[model samples]
Structures are given as structure tokens and as C-alpha cells.
Target: MQVITSESVFSGHPDKVCDQISDTILDAILEQDKKARVAVETAIKDDFVFIFGEVTTTAKVDYKEVAINKLKEIGYDEPFNVLEKISKQSPDIALGVDSTESHEQGAGDQGIMFGYACNETKELMPLPIMLANQISKEMDNARKEKYSHIFGPDGKCQVSVEYEKGKPKKVKTIVVSAQTKSWINRELYEDIIINEVLTKVLDDKAIREAEILINPTGEFVIGGPYADSGLTGRKIIVDTYGGYAKHGGGAFSGKDVSKVDRSGAYYARYVAKAVVRANLADRCEVQLGYVIGISNPVSIHINTFNTGVISDEAIQGLVSKIFDFRPSMIRKELLLDEVKYQDLAKYGHCGREDLNVAWESVDLKAKQLRKLYEETKRASQVL
Candidate 1:
């Protein structure tokens, strides 16, 4: 039996906590100064929290208050030390992004971004990642509600799915780990996780005969930053396709849309989803490369993974026709100024049906691709 695995962390997870803190600060800046340029990173170890990065904005951001509030929001109210080390954007870098010879908006930095989609799920996301994210979400919700007294905030879940001939058949195994209150018994902790969390996302058919493991280490009373250090961008895999797709190694949180690492990747997803939505391919991965101070991407790649209805080359042309890879154009298409990056920090930056994000909209572009594809097929048949 062929099997694939994916894993996700809850909001209270140390790395995710840092991600949220970074994005929350970005959100705060954008709310006041939409044109702000930000590239912030957060790190947590024990009781020390450090917020460091560059900022070019006039927004009044109380770094300490924002960090403390974010920790409290995540249910970590213990006393902690907060540090801030931020500066204005480098003049040399700003010259290119702010005023280029081409007069087009340049990328925030030089990097590569990747986006992918598949027909495995309605949202066009891989099966294992979707299931893993759902399981993690369930845990986060339960911990914030009546179960708060029974379970701590930090938690994660991993899902393994068995596939028959490349199509998922059933879940094979599920592993979950979460911090529990010291007073909670082991049996009760496991019971709460299974019943209140896992079962909520999995049906009897999925869980039946499946190997379920919970807190294998036993008595996970010590977790969060106190147990392990965390830094922003550390959960890049969990924040996107759960390692189901290739990542450009650029993170989404703690930066403005001007950063190609965030916007370029988001735009790539937008185009890839359009291709799958239009039935041009069963699965598609889009890769984009950008150079700092350049509006247009240096390279654009489309891979259909042997599942394209038309040739990959033909699909590539169609994508170019329907979408623009210029940094300024992408920002306009995805309405980057209006998005709440903090909301995207949880669950993932992609495959989000819960949030009405701009990149997730593909109906119009899908229609355009479908129309053009039918014409292209007819012409080829005649040839």
C-alpha cells in the first residue's frame, strides 16, 4: 500500500506562536499605514521573547505591548521578557523598491516562491495535508473552549494516508501530541484528545483499524517556549502544503505584500489553482523567481506532473495570457493591501476555504483558461 504523510501545528505551538506574533504586528502596521514596508521576525526561548527586523513606516507600534498581548491571546499569560530591535529599511534596498529606473514596483528582495494545487480535495489541496490541518484545528478550538482547564495550548497532529494507485483510500495512522494540565490523568488526556479532537475531524471509517498514538512521550506537561525554542518562519512547511508540495523556503508571516517571498508565492498559487479549476491539469505546481528591485520575475515555471489535459508548454502560454507575473500587478490582483496576514498565519497560507482570501478566487481566470484551451485543442486536431 502506498502511503503519504503530513503534519500541522496548532496556534499555540511555539513556532506558530512566533508566526502569529509577527503577522499580528504586520497587520497592525498595515491597518494604519497601508504602504508600510515590514520584514519582522520573532523568536521565543523560555521567558525571553525577541522581536527584531526592519521597518519603514510611520505607524505607531508598541512592540512590547503587541508581543505580550499576542502571548496572552494564545493563553500564555506567564510573565515574560520582551525585547525589540528594529530599524528602518536599508537605503540601498529602498532605492530599488521605492524608485526603480523602470518606474515599476520592485520586489522586496531576491528569492524564489512555489505554489501547487491538486484535485485530491475540493480546495485543490493534497489529502494528507488537509486532514492533518483539520486535526490540528480541532485541537486548537477545544483548547480555547471548555477544555482549556484540561489541556494546554501547545499541540500538533500528523496524519498518514494510504493510497491505492495514487488515489487516497483511507487513513492509516494518526499521531497527536499536546500539553495537558498536570492534574489530568493519562487516560483522560488521551480520551479527550481522541474524542474531542481527533474524532471531530475523522469519521469511524477513517479511524477504524487505524493506529492512533497520543502523547507517546507520556505526560506532556512541559511544552511551549519553556520546553523548546521557536522562531518565525520555522514552520514554513506547516504554514503551506504540510510538505506535500515544494516550498521556495520563503515565509509568509512578518512581511508586507511587497515581499515577493509572500506575494509572489501567493500569486503562483492563484495561477495554479486556476489551472486545476479549469481542468487544464489534474495537478499543477507553479514556480516564480524574483530579483530585488525588479518588477518582473526572472523565471516562471509550470509543472503539470504528467496530468495535464494539454501540453505543459501550451498550459504555460495560457497562464501567461491570463495572469501577470509583475510584482505590482500581483499585488493588485490579490488585493494584498486588504488581506489580514495574521489570519493566514494559522492553519495555512494556502487552501483556506474558511477565509475569503483574494488568491483563492479563480472562477474568472478558470473560465478564461477553459475557453482558450478548447480553442487550442480544436486547432491542434485540425493540424
Candidate 2:
């Protein structure tokens, strides 16, 4: 048996909190200015939430108000005392990203982004990551439902799955560390958390038999930003493919669609999903590269783990024929500037079929890809 490990962070976890705050600001700005160039970064330590990044837009917005309101919405209250401690973005980075020409729009900063897909889950996401995300979402719902006294805004979940011959067989272990107000005692907290939260969230029999660890280090009374320091772009793995694929090291939060790092990654996933849904491959991964000041991708690479009926190069040809990887072309195709990303900041971004994110739409492209795959397969057989 082979073991695979995957992890997820709760919305109130310091880094995730920072991510949500940054994207929330981005959404607000984009709502006002569809073409707004936003590259907001956020940091949280103790009671304070500090935001810094670049923004080039004509819309007038109250940054502080946006910060406070987002905090309140995330379940932090005035009595919690986390709201009064928020800050603004830096102007230096703003100068570079605030540009008129679409091509001249420098990356808010240099880094890489990754997109991945697999046949493990219905969503084409890796099994460990899919389970981890489901657990995190369950944690949020538990908090909303007040099911567990010991569960709070900040939490982390990790799942290790055992595989047989590259196929996932069973869950090996499940770990959850959640924060709570001091109202509950340790033993009682453990009971409610494990029995109600963990058990209820992972009701699936496959996960129920796994080793369960709840707050392994014990007391979590001090959690959230108060206990740790958080910065934007810190949760990139959590943002996209969940370390299941190679990342370009580019962060997504705060940057506008003009920046290929964010927009291009979305487009790559869009293409990858199409390939998998069309039965071109049981698993597929797509890589898209862009050079600065260029509209077209430097290169596009596809890997199908040998499950593809056609060679990867042939798949690439079909992709090149079918999809546009240019930055401007991607922005228009995916409707990047139009979608509100703030909601995506909290949940796992990729598997959201309900959100109507442009990348999630495979109806049109899937058919095209299916036809291309059939044509390529027939040609290969004849050869």
C-alpha cells in the first residue's frame, strides 16, 4: 500500500484569514472597477490585521472599512477585539502594477502558479485533497451550526490515504487541530470535537476507520492571528491544486486578471478539466508559461499519466487549436475581471462546480476536446 498526505486550513487560520481579507479587498475593487489592478497582501499577528500591496484603480473605497467588515463577516466580533487592529496597503508595489497597457502590466511580483487534475474524485481532484477540503468545509459548517463547543474559527486538517498500485484504497489517518473560546474544558472539548465534529463531518465509512487526532498538542485556547503571524501568498498550495501538481510559485490573492500568474493558472485548469471530462485521460495536468510583456503563452505542456488515448503532444496540438493561452485572451475567455473571487478565498477553489467560475465551465470545451481526441486516436491507429 502507498500512502499520500494532504492538509487543509480553516478559514480562521491566520494565513487563510489573511488570504480571505486580501481577496475580499480585491473583489470590492473589481466590483467597482472591472479593470482594477489589485495586488493586496495581508498579515495578521496577535490582534492586529495589517494589509499591504499595490492597487491601481479609479474607484474610491474605504480600505479600513473593507477590512473591518470582512473580519466581522468571518465570525470575528467587536467583543473578540480582533477588528480594531487593521492596517492599509503599501504604495511602493502599487506603482508597478497600476498600468494602462494590458501587456505592460508587470506581475504584481514574480512567482509561479500550478494547476492539476486527476480521476480520483468526481471533481478530478486528488483524493487526499478532496477529503481534506471536505473536512475543512465541514468544520466551517460545524461552526455555523454550533455543533461543537470546542471548535472555533481557526483550524487545520490533514488526511493520509493509503494506495494500492497507485489507486487510493483507504484513509490511513486524519488529523484536526481546532481553536475554541476558553469556555470548554480540555476533556469535554476532546469528546465533543471528536464525536460531533470529526465524526459528523467524515461520516463516510472509509474515513471513519482511520486514526483520529484532534488537537494533538492539546490546548488551543490561543489560536487565530493572535497566536501566529500570517502573510498573503502563504497558502498557495491550499489555494490551487493542493500540492498534487507542481506549482509555479506564483501567488493568486490580490492580483488582477491581467497578471498571467492568476489568470493563466485558471485557464490551464480550464483546459485540464476539459481533457479529463472528455475521457482523453483518467488524469491530466496542464502547464502554461508566459513571458513578461507578451500576450501568448511561452509554452503549453500537457501530461496524461499514460491514460490518454492520444500522445500528450497530440493533446497539446488539439489544445493549441482549441484554447487561447494569451493573457488577454485568457482574461476574456474566463471572464476573470467579472467574477467575484472573494467567496472562493475560503473554500477550495477548483472543485466548485456551483460557483460558475469561468474555469469551471466545461460544457463547450469538453465536446470539442472529445471530438479532437477521437480524431487523433483514429489517426494514430491507422498509422
Candidate 3:
């Protein structure tokens, strides 16, 4: 059996702690100042949290208070001393990015960002990542609601799924390393985690026969920032397709949508999902390239992995016509400014049904593109 693995972390995980804090600050700033330019980063170790980056906003945001509150909300009640080192965005960089009467807004920075979609899951995401993320969410929910006495805030999950002919056939293994109360008996702890967390999400045969490892390293009393140091943008693979696709190395949280890293990536996923939803392909990945201070993408490309009903070239042509890739247009089309980065900070960003993100709802584009694909197919069988 061929196996592919993907992992996810609980909200209290060190890196996620930083991710949430950064986005929480970003959210607060955006709420007060829609036009603000924010690119923040967070790092944590022990009882210390460091927030540093470039932020130009009139939102009157209390960055320190916001970061501390977010930490507490993630189930960390420890006293954390925070150090803030923030500065304004450089006017030199901002000069080319801002919109003018004659010049449209350009990209925030130069980089490659990828978006992916497949029919393996209802969310059009890879099964391994979707399941891994669900287990983590369930773990956090259990700690918050039922087993507060037994579980701690920090934890992680990795799921390896067996595939047959490129399709997921079953789950092969589940590895859970979670923070737990030291007093809980080993027997009861495993039972609770097995029944309450694992079975609740993966009761099917996929999980029943699989090997499940719980608290592999024994005691988990020491967890969260106390256990390890965490920095933002470190989990880029977990944030997106879970190693099923390539990443352009851009982190989404903490930055406002003005940065093409966040906005452009969202738009790329929107296009990939649209292609799959249109039945033009069973799998899709769209890559968008931008140069800082340029409003439009320097390159737009697509790969259907030989799963497209039409040729990749035809699909790329359709994408050019149906979607707008300009920095300003991407923000406007996806309603980026209106979204709360904190909500997307935890779960995987691309394929989310829980959040009402514009990128996920590509039905309008799907319908139009499906019709266009039919005409294009008739016009050129060569495609």
C-alpha cells in the first residue's frame, strides 16, 4: 500500500499560537482601519512573546493587549510578558503598491503562490490533510468542553493514508502526541482519546484497523510555549495542501490582503476550486506570479495533472477570461478586506467549509466556466 502523510496542530501549539496572535492583531487593525497596511509576525518561548513587523494603520490598535488576549483564548493562562517591535511600512515600498488616479494597485511582494484542488474529499482537498486537521480540531474541542481536567492546550496529529491508484483507500496509521494531565491514568487517557477524539472523526474501517499511537513520549504536562519556541509562517505546508502540492513560501496570517502573498494565494485557490467544480478537471493547481508594486500578475499558469476534460492550455485561456488577477481586483473579487484572518489562522486555509470565505464559494465562476468549456471544447477538439 502506498501511503501519504499530512499533519495538523491544535490551536495551542506553539507555532499556531503565534499564527493566531498575528492574525488577531491583523484582525483588530483591519476592523478599525480597512485601508491599513499590516505585515506582522509573532514568536513565543516560555513566558515571552515577541511581535515585530511593519504596520501602518490609524486603527488605534493596542497590539500588546490583543496578543496577550489571543494567547489566553488558546487555553494558555500562564503569565506572558510581551515585547513589541513594530514599525511603519516603508514609503519606498508603498509608493509602487498604492493605487493612484493613473496607476492601479500593484502586488505587495514578489513570489510564487500555488492553489490546489482534488475530488478526493467533499471539500475538494486531499483526504490526509482534511482528516489530520479534523482530528486536531476535535482534540481542541475535547479539551475546551469535556476533558479540561485531562488535556492541555498544546498537541499535534499526523495521519498517514494508504492510496490505491492515486485514490485514498484507507487510513494506515494515526499518531497523536498531546498534552495531558499528569495525574490521568495511562489506560483512561488512551481510552478517552481513542473514543472521544479519534473515533468521533474516523470511526470508519479506515481508523478501526489502523495503528493509533497516543502520547508516544509519555508525560505531556509541559506543553505550549513552555515546551518549545514557535514562530509564524513556519507551517506553510500544513497551512495549505499538506505536501500534496507545491508552496510559494508565503504565509497568509498577520498580513493584510494588500500583500499578494495572502490575496493572490486566495485567488489562486479560488481558480483551482472553480476548475474542479466546473467539471473541467478532477484535480487542479494554479500558480500566480507577481512583482511588487505591480497591479497585475506577471504570470498565470495552470496544471490539471492530466485530469482535465479539456487541455491545460484551453483551461488556462478560460481562466484568463473569467478571472481577474490584478492585486486590486483580487482583493475586490474575493472581498479579502472583509475576512477575519484569525478565523482562518488555525484550520487549513484553502478548503474550508466552516468559514464563509469568498474563495471557497466559486459557484458563480464554476457555472460560467463550465458553459465556456463546452463551447471551447467544440471549437477545438485538438485542445
Candidate 4:
């Protein structure tokens, strides 16, 4: 059987903590200024949190307050303790993002972004990633619920699934590492994780046979930002499709939708989801490219992996005809400029059909794509 493995981290993980912080700031700015130019980066080391990067807008919001408040909301009860540890944004980077013209919008910075979809799951997300995220989220919930003797904020989860003939067949291995207060012994820690976290996460009987690794490295007393330096964009793979597809290398956590890296990726996913929902393809991957200062996309590519009844080229043509890939157009299409990304900062970004995110809405586009596919099939049959 073919095998595919994927991993996910909890929100309290150092890298994810940074991501949440950055996006929280972005959302705050966007709330006041719909056209806010935000490119924020956060770094967490030890007990200290350092926020850097730039944002330009008319909104009169306090960055420091926002940062501290957001941290506190994310289960950090000791703000005074952590606040003294954090720093402010740098003035140099702020100069570039505080621009006026549409074309003048430089990418908050240069990087690549990727969007992907497949028939492996109803959300078109890979099963391994979906499973990994489930486990990670469950761990967080268990901690929040005060599950006895579990762990602290820092945790990571990985799932490797055995695939048969390119499809997931059964679970292979499950690994979870969670940091606990110094008092908890390893024996009790393992018992708590297995019974409370893993059991609840993989409730399906099919997953019971999988191998389990609880803190494979042994001691996790030194976790969180203290043990490891955490920075924004470090978890890009986990944020997106868990390496099931290619990543453009652009991180999504800190930038506003104007940056194609964020908005464009969301639009690409929307297009792919629509294609699959229309039954034109069982799986789809859409790629979008843009030039800084240009409103329209520089390139758009589609891959359906022979799942489409129409040629890839034909699918591309239809996509170009139906979807708008321009930065401005994408913003309008997805209403992304209005989305509150801070909440999405935690949890997996994709597969959040519950969030009512514009990218998640395929109802309108799905109908249109199905009509296009039916017309194409009719024409081909006539020939």
C-alpha cells in the first residue's frame, strides 16, 4: 500500500503562537481600514514576544495593547509576565507597507504561496493533514477543559496513513508530543495523552491499530517559546496542505489580502474546490501568479490529474473565463478584505467550512462550473 504522512501543531505551539499574533494584528487593522496595508511578523523566544514588520492605515489602534490582549485571550493568563518579555514593531519595515496607490502595493515582502485540493476528503484536503489537525486541536481542547494531568500549551501531532493504490487505506502511525508542567511525571503524562487526547482524536475504530508515539523524544519539560525560537511563517506547511501539494513559499500569517500570497492562494483553493464539486474533477490544484503593482494575475495554471472529463487546457480556459484572479478582483470575489483572519490564526486554515470564509463558498461557482462542464460534454458528444 502507498503511504502518506502529515503533521499539525496546536495553537499554543511556538510557531503557531507567532502566527496567531500576526494575524490578530492584521484583523484588528482591517476592521478599521478595509484597505489597510499590513505586513506583520512575530517572533517568540523564551518568555518574550517580539513583534516586527509594518502596517499602514488610518486606524488609530494601539499595537502593543492589541498584542497583549490577543496573547491574553489565547490562554496566556499572565500578561504582565509575558508583556514585559515582548517588543514593538520595527519602524523601517513599516515604511514600505504604508503605501497609497493600488499598484504601489509591494508584496508585504517577496515570497510564494500555494493552494491545493483533492478527493481524499470532503473538504478536498489530504487525509493525513486532516487527521493530524484533528489530533492537535483535540489536545488543545483537552487542556482548556482542564483534563487532569495532561500538559501545557505546547504540543505537536503527526499522522502517517497507509495508502493503497494512491488512496488512504488505514492508519499507520500517530505521534503526539505535549509539554507538561514540571511536576507531572512521564508515566502519568503518557497515560493522560493516550487516554484523553489520542483516544478522543481518532475515535474511529479503523485508526485503533495504528502505532502511537507519545513524546517520542521523552522529556518535554522544556517546550513552548522557551525551548525553541518561534517565528511567523515557520509553519507554512502545516498552515496549508501539510506538504501534500507544492507550496509557493509565501507565508500567510501576517499579510492582508492585498498581498496575492494570501488572497490569491485563497482564490486558487476556491477555484479548485468548485471544479471538484462540479464533478469535472475528483481532485484539483490551481496555481496563481502575480506581479507586484499589477492588478491582474501574471499566470494561472490548473491540474486535475486526469480526473477531469475535459482536457487540463480546457479546464484552464474555463477557469480563466469564469474566475477572476486579479488581486483586486479576488478581493472583490472573496470579500477577503472584510474577513477577520485573527480567529483563523488558530486551527487549520483550510477545511474550515464552518467559518463562512469567502473561499469556502463554492455554491455559486459550483453551479456555474457544472453548467460549463455539461455544455462542454454536449459539444464533444455532438462532434
Higher-lDDT candidate of 2 and 3: 3
* Model 2 misplacement above 4 A: 78-112, 147-149, 186-188, 191-195, 199-201, 379-383
What C-alpha lDDT values do all the predictions have? 0.90, 0.76, 0.90, 0.77
Model 4, runs deviating above 4 Å? 79-112, 185-187
Among all windows of 10 consecutive residues in model 2, the one with the lowest summed lDDT is 79-88
Model 4 — which ten-residue stretch has the worst lDDT? 80-89
Name the better of 2 and 4 by lDDT: 4
- Model 1, clash count? 0
| lDDT at position 12, candidate 2 | 82
Residue 353, candidate 3: alpha-carbon lDDT: 78
What TM-score, to 2 decimals, does candidate 4 have?
Answer: 0.90
Name the TM-score of candidate 2.
Answer: 0.89
- For model 2, residues 1-383, the per-residue Cα lDDT tens digits are 78888888888888888888888888888888887767778887776777776677777777677777877777666532233222333565445544555434443444344567778887778888878877888788878777445566888889898999878988889888878778877787667656766666566585468898878887677877778888878887777766777788777776778677788778888999899888878888888776555556667789998988778988888988899766666777888777777777866778777688989888799899888777877887999
Local accuracy of candidate 1 as per-residue lDDT tens digits, 1-383: 79899999988899999999999999999899988999999999999999999999989989889889999999998998999999998988887787556587899899999999999998999989898888888888888877899888898889998999778898899999888989988888788877777778878776767899998887688999988899999999988888889999998899998899999999999999999999999999999999999888899999999999878988999888889988788888888888888888888889997888988988899999999989888898999
lDDT of 4 by residue, 244-309 (tens): 888888888888876778887888889988888777887788887776655566677888888887
State which candidate, 1 or 2, has the greater lDDT: 1
Candidate 1 lands at a TM-score of: 0.97
